[model samples]
Target: MIEARQLTKRYGDKTAVDGVDFTVRPGAVTGFLGPNGAGKSTTMRMIIGLDAPTAGTVTVNGRRYAEHSAPLHEVGALLEARSIHPGRSAFDHLMVLAHTHGIGRARVTEVIEMTGLQAVARKRAGAFSLGMGQRLGIAAALLGDPQTIMLDEPVNGLDPEGVLWIRTLLTGLAAEGRTVFVSSHLMSEMALVADHLIVVGRGRVLADTTVQELVLQAGGDTVDVTTDDPAGLRRVLTGPGVEISGRPGSEQLSVTGLPARAIGLAAARHGIALFELTARTVSLEEAFMELTKDSVEYHAANTLVGAA
Candidate 1:
């Protein structure tokens, strides 16, 4: 597991990361989410000892990364910026890293095969495509078979096949009780993989919760009800936190703050006939936008990138 306590970073007079605290547990995938310039990259750097924390501390597997005798075996990280020699072949790159920790050539070959780099293991890294390069980076991360794995924007240039492969690989790692912390802009994909989330904004931790809870907190769950007597059902269901709104001249009622079952029960009590009742939910992307709207450092004039 990875733990951060009041972690902070400063570069001269500017502060990149505030006093942020969060824990990434084992046996599940924990998603790290933030907008641009939210200090996410800085925080990740501190976790792996790429940068010294200005204050507080971060530890992987119950100890600081530097304190571990075999640091690679304790945690493996793949950041956005690639750390690779362009002239070397994928196989040579992994082999060189393996040699650092006394890892054997067999382990290097295993990661190469695991990352689907077997076909191009002998090819020079400079000649590899973006997706192929990403595969090589992932190969290095898995080289140690570490207990903790952290990745930032891992699917940046991956094709659909590579994307699916990563999804399966992460889940399999978590299934083995390993700590899997992934940061991605693909909310649709993270919704499917992450069991928990740590959302940050403005160099501060905004929320630490599950995917389901985050969605619910974004205006609760919505429901759709198409009834023959919209007015009658509306009269019975509309109360306190319940809301009923629909397009003009439409019989369907768009509901909020109430479960479909509860609405059905209320309608039944009022002897209202319903043709359809369906529960609608907010997506993870929608929730993220709602939670971080005020914390965004930059705004695009021509795009709704956060919402869409």
Candidate 2:
């Protein structure tokens, strides 16, 4: 597990991270989310001891990351920047990291195969494509078989197959009771993999909760109801705090502020024939946008010019 208490960082007169605190537990994937310039990178750097925190403390397991005798075995990290040497081959890169902790060549070979880099193990790191480079980085992360794994944007340049591969890999690691902390801007992917989330904005933690809770907090789950008498059902369902909308002449009604059970019962009382009713849950992306709407550093104009 990874824990940070009042963790902070500053540069000259600017504060990059501000008294942020969160815990990443084992046996589940925890997603790190934030808008641009929200101090996510700074926080991650502090956790791995790449940058010293100006105040407070962070620990991997029960001690600071640097305090472990075999740091790589305690925690494996793949930060945003590529840390490989351009002159080294894929196999050589993993070998170098493995050598630091006295890891054998067999483990190095295992990771190469695990990441599907066996086809290009001997290729120069500089000549590899972005996806291939990412694979190499992951191979290095798994070299030590650390108890905790942290990755930033692991799917940046991956294809659909590679994306699915990484998703399965992360879940499998968590199932083994390893701490998996992943930071990514891909909300759709995070929604699929992460069980918990730590959302940050403006150098502070905006939310630390589960994916389901956050979505419910943004706005209650929406329900889709289809009835033969749309107009009659709309009138019967309309009430205080309840919202109902549907397309003109359409049999479907989009509803909020009430659950499927309540809607169905209400329709039954009114003798309205229901054709379909589905409880549509709010997505992680929607919740993130609502929670971080005010914290976003940049905004794009809605209208675009010179469109084809």
Candidate 3:
């Protein structure tokens, strides 16, 4: 497990990570989410001892990363794939990391096969495609056979097949009772992989909850109803705590705060001609946009002008 207690960091006049507390439990994939410049990268760097925190503390397996006797075996991370030397071959890079910890060639070969890097093991990393570089980076992270894994933007440059492979790999790792913490801005991808989420903005923690809980907290359910007389349907739904709006390109009414069955029953009671009635649950992307809309630091020119 990984824990942070009142963790904080600052650079001169700007604070990168505010005082925050959270726990990353084992046997599940926890997603870290936030907008750009929201302190996620800074927090991960502090957890791995790459940056010193100005206040508070973080620990992995009950000890600071610097205090671990075998740090690589305890926590394996892929903060940024491009951190490796560009001129080195994939095999040589992993070998150098192994030499530092006295790990053997067998373990290196195992990770190469695990990440599907056998075909390009001898290619210079600088010449490899972005997707191949991501694979090599993952291989390095798994080289130590660590119990805790943390990756920042692991799927930034992956193809569809590579993306599917990562999803399966992360699920398998968590099933083995290991701690998996990954950060990404892709809400759809995170929804498919993560069991829980940690949302942050403006150097502060906004939320720490399960995926289901986050969705519930965002808002009520959405129900889409299609009828021959949308106007009549809207009139019937015009009541307290219920909202009706027109759906694009169809004779459908978007209803909120009402169940699909209730809408259907209302139409049936009125003898209205109905074509369809279905519940439209909001996507994870929509929920995330609502959660972090106000916390975003930088906005596009049009948005900024509108806000002003």
> What overall lDDT goes with each candidate model?
0.91, 0.93, 0.91
Candidate 1 error regions (>4 Å): 224-235, 238-254, 261-265, 268-279, 303-308
Select the stronger candidate by lDDT from 1 and 3: 1
TM-score of 2: 0.88
Which candidate leads in lDDT? 2
lDDT of 3 by residue, 165-279 (tens): 9999999999999999999988888989999999999889999998887886665588888888888788887899887888655697788888989888888898888888888
On a 0 to 100 scale, what is the lDDT of residue 264 in model 2? 97
For model 2, which pairs clash? none
Point out the higher-scoring one by TM-score: 1 or 2.
Answer: 1
True-vs-predicted CA distance for residue 112, candidate 3, Å: 0.5
Candidates ranked, most accurate by TM-score first: 1, 2, 3
Q: 2 or 3: which has the higher TM-score? A: 2
Off by over 4 Å in 2: 224-257, 271-279
- Model 1 misses residue 78 by how many Å? 0.3
Ranking by lDDT: 2, 1, 3
TM-score of each: 0.89, 0.88, 0.87
